[model samples]
Target: MSKKVILITGASSGMGKETAKALIQEGHTVYTVARRIDHMQDLKNMGGYPIQMDVTNENDIQNVVDTIIKHESKIDVLWNNAGYGLYGAVEDIPVDEARKQFEVNLFGLATITQKVVPYMRQAKSGTIINTSSMGGKMYTPMGAWYHASKHAVEGFSDCLRLELQEFNIKVVVLEPGVIATEFGEVMLKNISQFSSKGAYSSLTNQLVTATKKMYDKGQGSKPTVISKTVSKIVNETKPKTRYRVGLWAKPMVWMRIYLGDKLFDKIIMSQLS
Candidate 1:
């Protein structure tokens, strides 16, 4: 296989970090970008280019794109994976905070994709792997903003795939279920303000407790599972539009499709409760 130049955002941790390492191991020139440069120091040691990037910053994103174009001449794969979950009821989470979540999860991702698309178009061969989640397809309590962002990604990726087909640009969505990561901690921290006396308090606590338990018990899939799936998608001659990996992702997608909204809601509520 020919060596490809790949750029992955959110490479400081979780699935992104694992995927960057795996891609580098597979002989790809990997450039890993995230806000936490220190977290990616090991990646740099392994020959992966570590780029300090806050996806929410338009200038920083544009700079990364320009840097890639200047050095590599072309980017074979652009992994849009920098995102976080803000878990809280829609009514409880501050509107501005919710908007901030969208800025990072939706707008930021879209901005980077826009900057990279022209290069990929010129190359006429590239893959864009977007990191979505099972919540994108199914409803989950206390994850309104996060779910909305992933749903947006689902739609955005679908549209891009259709539009870029003629240009040989493949848009793949990686939908991971609950993975053992610091994601839960970040969600908890982001929604702490909404944890007191409200209609959502009990539900929020239940959901948080369940999430903590799952993480502690190691019931969720490892980051490497998703990383391996991403590697396969990047390396495939013809990749599928969506790769739903991890334990509950497939089941959740099937349930959402087959059981309808009401039943699925009941199932999810029961699981959290």
Candidate 2:
């Protein structure tokens, strides 16, 4: 396989970090970006280029793009993976916080894609992989904002794939189920605010408790699983438009499609309960 120049966002931890490492091991020039530069120092030590980037900052993204263009001359792959989970009840999460979630998960991702597209167009060949979630297809309680953002990613990626197909630019969506990460801790923190004494307090506490327990028990797949799937997508000559990774991703997607909405909702509710 030809060594490709790849730029991966959110590479400070979890799947992004693992993917960067795997790509580098395969001899690809991996440029990893994230807010915490220190978290990516290990990646740099491993021969992956680390760039301090916050997707919400347009200038930061532009700088990274410009740097890559200047040094690599062209980017062969773009992993739009910078995102977070802002889990809370819709009624409890402030509208501003909800918008911020979209800003980071959806708008920020789109912004980086926009900056990279012209370069890909110039090269006339490139692969764009987006990190969506299983929640993108199947909804879960207390994650309304996060799910909405991911759903937007689902739609955005689909449209982008269609639009960029004629340009020989492949757009792929990576949908992952729960993985052992700091994501659950963040979600639990958000839940505390929503679960504060109120009409929905009981349900909120139940949901938070269940989520925390699942994560604490380490019931989710490892980040390496998703990272391997990403490596295949990056290296394959012909990659699937969507690669659903992790333990529950495929089963949940199947249930969402075949079981219909009512049943799916019941299953999801039961999971939380």
Cα TM-score per model: 0.97, 0.97
Model 2 CA lDDT for position 220? 91
**Going through the candidates in order, what is the number of backbone clashes in each?**
0, 0
The local lDDT score (0 to 100) that residue 195 gets in candidate 2 is 52
* Cα RMSDs, all models: 1.1, 1.1
Please report, in order, the local distance difference test score of every candidate based on alpha carbons: 0.90, 0.90
lDDT per residue as tens, model 1, 30-64: 99999999999999999999999999999999999
Q: Which pairs of residues clash in candidate 1, taking residues 3 or more apart in a chain or in different chains?
A: none
Query: Model 1: which ten-residue window has the lowest total lDDT?
Result: 188-197
The superposed Cα distance between candidate 2 and the true structure at residue 162, in angstroms, equals 0.8
User: Where is model 2 poorest over a 10-residue stretch in terms of lDDT?
Assistant: 193-202
Candidate 2 residue 160 Cα shift, in angstroms, is: 0.5
